[model samples]
Target: MGARVTIVFAALAAIHTLTPTAQAADAFATPAVTINRADWRAAMDQLRSELNAAPEVAADFALTARRRSVAADDPRQRPALVQLNGVTSAIFTGIGRSPVPVLLPFDTTAYLAARRKGAIDPQALPRHQADFQTDLFDAGPSGYDAVFSLPTEATSGLPSRVFARPVEIQITGSVLTYDVADPAGGKGESVKALAAQYPDLRRFIREGYVRYAFTRFGVPYVVSIQCLDSAPRPRRLACREASPIAERFLKALRIAGGQPRRLPPEIAPAAIERPPAPDPDFTYRPAGDIVVNSGARGQSGRADLTAYSQIRYPLDAPAYVHSQSFGRRRASDKFDQPWSQYPWRDNFCEARSFNVGQCASGFGHQGQDIRPGACPVRRDGPEACDPWRQRVLAVRDGVVIRSTRQQAVTVQVNTGTEHIRFRYMHMNPSALDADGLLNGRSLREGQPIGVVSNYLDHPNGTTRHLHFDVQLFTRDGWIWVNPYMTLIAAYERLIGGRGHEIGTEMVSSSVAAPAITGTLPPAAGPQADAVHAPN
Candidate 1:
């Protein structure tokens, strides 16, 4: 540690303000390639058909991060701000004694402000504490700051970070530098074997780490070794210092263990204990005039929703129909069959009892409810409780950013400002476990994310329909965007036609409509938190 430089948050903010703001024009727009939905669907179909035709192969290798410690005497010091490429990052130091570091979108101003005050407001932290950043703490003149945590010296001494959340690297040994003498010779083998063949590489991992750096979305990504339990402090290495260091590090890394099972562990099937079904007398109504909530800006105008944003359907084509439309007040008379509809339209703002002015106070139904056409009846003709039989499809090509098993699955589309989040709820728990749905997995349009089921905490909490919704990235963070028209548009594309009404069809006709309860009561029970829509 010859010289130490600590760049605090305030200085970082000042420097960032002074830096040139001009960025490549293309960065503000999505990719130039136009998406042809038909072609995309055909490609997906072909890929699936080919997969069904291919032979299954067993996984042959296990990839695991080995626990290796770097020597204590390593001299490298962690940089306050390491920005080699487009990405500018800071090391995350875990909260309290937690070994894992908290990685979040960098927000220099907040971090500096927190540091200056020698405390952090817990309420100011990102709402989605795991992976996001917001200006929730910087509401300067507003008296809404009480939502943040009590100020504490949590981030006081750390380097000025892009975010108030700290970034940290796990420590172990010194930064080991290496080079490949011959690329052709070092093909496949463990470091131990490689050390025996190339004696010069023997002391690498045991003593230090091989560092590498790159960038994505104007963000820099750096890889390096950590020197843990070091005498003076932890050490890090820069891959750019020497090309051989990177090449040799790559050659030394190899899969040594045999392949492990790819399937995730299965969870026990959650039991379905149906609550006393509601017998509310709700009137059936078709989609009425679109009421504009003047309080909410993006939703004030009346526009054809079905013709807006490009997105695919969540359910399979043709057969599935909308039981309730966005503004429809129609609901099933039977308490147990909540998803059963009256008007053959889609259901959106049925939670009107929660609050008035649909999209204004964020108190109304935020999304639409869709069902898989008919309920399968058992042999004796009772409602067939086979909720997992139907498939829930991805509405677009996006990343499965958040997959909380049965709770929900949220896919995010990241095409510049067109970025939107699609969430699917009421997935079968067992099916979700079997399919190994997890976070960070990239998904294609039409991929089967999970089976349709009523598994919200319990199997019988609600009806067996996917509660689908859309969210947009706003200054307020990810806020609910009306999905009614989005679904209408997607459904039309799926059927290659307009929304078709069953019209005295078998299911609707057979199940006689319950007597209308002239005016429905205000939504009873507890009003759910607006931050999260009710299941």
Candidate 2:
């Protein structure tokens, strides 16, 4: 018993001795990781507070690696967001003349809305939105301003405003400005030879960008390198300067979901059937020869001098019905009429729609409205209503700037300084979705966008018809241009010898056509804007 008692006392003594050591260790040991975490949290909170306090600083935040909920963003905004998330997150490290770190540079939504507003280049606003923007001033690599190592954004709410200096940098894709080449050199071969001569081009192709340039309308363009690989490294530094930060930004990128349907093949221009009317003379016309002159209503001398015969008819059918034209006219004709009595005609400046100051005498119709076909008396008969038979075709080669599912689709031709726009309204929204006519998609001339319908705010706001109009960018902003002469020229080309009149069978896609190449001009630059395809 004494021995057991002694052992218990000794064990108690040892416990007492070890308790102080354990307590001391606990007291002296600092939680280095926990304290560091607290400090980081405080720093992040302070930084966010500072960013929120300064608009300019916050704008710059678009250049950094940060994210927020875009759940409330519009569906139209999704395509742009997907593009933004893509180009910004691609890692260009090891793809350039110099190796780069991972990066997230381009701000998709901000750039697309401002691309044509003249932020980067003052000469012409970009008519089409692209996935990336280059240094118009060419800030990187001496004499190689084309290197797109930096992501760019125009000042918020001020697209035309130029920055005092280039501030942000990025890892972006490369583009060949072949259109800028001199014509004296055999335009096509010169680009290839120039590419052969450029060392950086070699460097870009080795580790950086996919090689491409805009093919011209058979016109020779100058070749220049723009924005390739990643941002420039700091002098004296052998590797990427912003790599670590860029890596963080890359990880933060959130790619938007869903995919667009593949674009269908284009219709050969030679195969498009024409109306049965005599070919309209395309020679420069006198005002007296204008078919739909607004001057008939005492509004003369307001004609658009720049207007020419350019576009083709928007519909494809045997015959058309016209319940309305441009301007205000009280036509007692019911919405449903047989083709024999109400054949559609070329009516541009005729007296139906809203009033606009840009018209002949400050108060006239805004655009031409033509019905696809006569509606059947029965609401559920075979010929009751068939918008699909009147598929809307693009009149020119351009990018679809707006494809509002419920309202309209606007396509803009991006000529250097003479940008023009065409609008097609009253299309079936479900048909448009099925055809994949989303915003920013490219269209070939004669390409079917969708079927004509009577959709305005909902499915049946007006009778089944297509509203067409043209606009040109002038010093006074976008003004409506008469499409009379333009339609004459296009129709003559479409029909060849003499145009055919509306037949019992719709002219569009009805005539058995052999597969032939289309005559529409191909896009001249890298078509990397839509995320459906790679750059």
Candidate 3:
């Protein structure tokens, strides 16, 4: 009985196997109720009423038909319309760069009724209708090669304003006559004779009238001039005479006692009038004393003398003895030395040459060559003399925007969104632990992060050191700031001059002093001003 039931269930499942669903019959079917004659007639009536109210309906109708025809040919095309968003729509009839027609669709019944009532002439409507339908259905040529419907706001606003307020003198140009009468006839002999001499006079007259009308009467006018003659007998004289006459006419029509105003020059319309200059020294004040520092040579092992002697030296004063006396006899001697071995006893800042004893040479030491003790022969080498492996501290707190372990020699820290990037190069690969801490966690000022080694090669095959560079990005271009400023600034802030002394000792006798004996009184003179070192 169980077997029979199972077989019945399988048979039922098989009968209901997957198949394609049939499409709905109404899909793609045109509804008979669409385009109701009565509704269409009503819509047409309304459209005709609107057209009658619009003064430019004839031009608008011509433009609409042309656009509809183009749209019919290519249904994917957008209709021409003046967008309130201040953007012009696409052209359909190729009349203007913007082909979109701004006219709304006409209601057929109202349009037909208006034509029958003599409100809208059938003769005028048919020409435009035939032109539109021909282009739409038969792809036939149109009477107008190009047509454009002007913005309704631009056309209607002026007329509405004029109707609201009437002006006294209503100065107008010859172009108004052309638009009102036969456009060709308006450019008669007088216009030709005048324009032949002064070509730009007509333009000035036209613009003047437009400005005056718009400003006073709130009416907008367009000027059109036709030149009938090909050449003039006296061109120069005609222009000279016409220009003065046009100018005089404009000057005479100015509203009496209205307002004394200067018309802005067409060329530089946005120029602002400048105000008078303010008095000098109105907010001036004298600057305070400018104290300078000799810097941290005494503590950082950059100076060989006692801390007292180092601090006593005048800022910017020449070193009594060159770096050769401190151990690096030649520039080549310090090449490729580890950071631990960086002449802590000698002033690395004083060494100016890459070779021996030469100051200010082009091949001078590029960076401060520090001897970071000895290099670790093995990964697990003793750490007694070693400063700290990967114990490098950030020079300044900043975001770590980029991190790449593949480039073991350098680590880049982004200080800000500006292109200024701080580069900690020639780093010990092991110094940066799992969490990127140089030593255990934090690195103190002047504390060693890693022993600098010549394990890697430079492009020039010369000895390498920490190549610190400060760059500034400006509108003009990138500029290199002196890194010496950063070094001196950091040194002064960390040591005692501006603030209290760090220890009891005024100066240390030895480079690696375990303890200090006593403290000396602060030195006076310019050295006293060196208290806070400039960072």
Candidate 4:
């Protein structure tokens, strides 16, 4: 009765092992394109609206840089010194309040001296000039502000003992004209004092007018002033209070300032927003084995075959048959062929004569030489073996971590720490479709992708064969496994061969499987119970 029960249990286990779950669906799908024109248009519209509402206004006023001469003979024509270059203007555009433009004059010589040492090229005069202009106007919506370096020289009178020292003259003015009697006309004195010091009053007014235009039109302004002294030879001159004409002109001018107000909110609206791009699809799984042949009669000492010596066989047995047999091919007739027809015959001949295993020396051949019928070979080129080529499918579903199509190899990583890599080489370039895989799609067992080419240089000239190699990574480094063992295991399962023992061994060896903490399941019979009971 125990024997019968044991047999029954064994049969049940076999039945359960025969059925397996279906593979998961492919993760990748064709991507689509999307565009949003309305969002872009809305942003542009907002910018235009802001510009149209409460447009910019500019005001002009004259300022003077003057020096006094110690010449009693020509006091009326006192020596005058003025800024010839380097002036900047600023304008501030408030979101709700009135726009205000501020003009700050600079010492042009000092500005140029500092700028030449750091920001601008001292040697390139034109570039320096252009940069000065840019710095003056590009002060953003903030009002114009700057310092000017006024150039000075001595006028005739005591043999010109000294030079005029540079000074900054601040000028305030309005773009619109107004009478001193107006409520806002108090600002005129400040503007007049700003211009009273310079002898070149006309040039000052011209620059002031230009500045007003730029401010009014939302442009920037800069100017240079040049001055000449008209006193007797050999006299020292001070740049202040040099010219009465300039002082009179400034005194006659008037400026006004009105209270500012805010612009309406309806003129400017918020800009539209944009969405992000889609994320990439990802997948992960363990690699499956490829089976070649099954149920071939086991020769004596088969169990003694080491991993390195697994694929050794007689030369006359056609390369393709040997590969298929080792890989456990189900259909023996599919790959049976003569040795002479094999593409690697010449290389094999050389290996045989040299006793180098590259041919038939047998032990530790390094890499498997899959034949034409089992795995397509390209004698002419990569395209020649397209029809008979093996798919060289990905070991596991994963993102293409690294690809070297130029070298005909692709490495994929399933997990960050797994460190397990699969390399598929000698594949035809065309095999990788637009999506970068076989036919731009997923591959199955025994599917055709592209033929192996002779691009990889071998010991001989080059051999036309698939050089499929597997390398396992350990903490120390990589270790090569006799892939034929795994291949044969998969093949035997598919073709009616007894695989229960192998399956049990694999389950026991798998690193991913959970530990069996309890006793083994009940055996089929009484004899089986004795064999498993605490032993």
Point out the higher-scoring one by TM-score: 2 or 3. 2
Encode model 4's per-residue lDDT on 1-535: one tens digit a residue: 0001111122111111111112123211111111101121222232233223322210011122222432445322321110111122111121111122222322233333444346544344323222111111211111222222222331212232233332112222221111111121111112334443322222222101111111122212222221122231122222222232223223322111111222122111111111122212111111111121111121111111111111112111123312211221232333334431222211111111011111112212223445444333444554343334333444343323212122233232212112222344444433343345521133333333344454332111233445444333321112222333333322232232322212222422212222222333221111110111100
User: Considering lDDT, which of the candidate structures 2 and 3 is the better prediction for this target?
Assistant: 2
| Candidate 1 local lDDT, 102-171, one digit each (tens) | 1123343334335345675656544212222321110011000100111113333222212221122211
* Candidate 3: residue 60 lDDT (0-100): 36
TM-score: model 1 vs. ground truth: 0.39
Model 3 residue 236 CA deviation in Å: 70
Quote the positional error of residue 228 for candidate 4 in Å. Answer: 80
Best by TM-score: 1
lDDT of 2 by residue, 1-535 (tens): 0001111122111110001111131011100000000122222333344335545433433433434543344332333323332433232211122110111223333433353344644233221112223322211110011122222343332232122222222222111111111122121112243343221221111111112222111111112221123334221111132222222223222111111111112211111222444544322222222223433255443443223225666765333423242223334434345322232343344432223344444333345555554544435465444434556889887666432233557675643112456877777666776776755567898888877666654565555667777754321223455554345345455546343334323322211221111121111111122111000
In model 1, how large is the Cα lDDT of residue 394? 85
Provide C-alpha RMSD values for all models, in order. 23.8, 28.3, 34.5, 35.6
Provide the global lDDT of candidate 1 against the true structure: 0.34
User: Residue 174's C-alpha lDDT in candidate 1?
Assistant: 9
TM-score of 3: 0.23
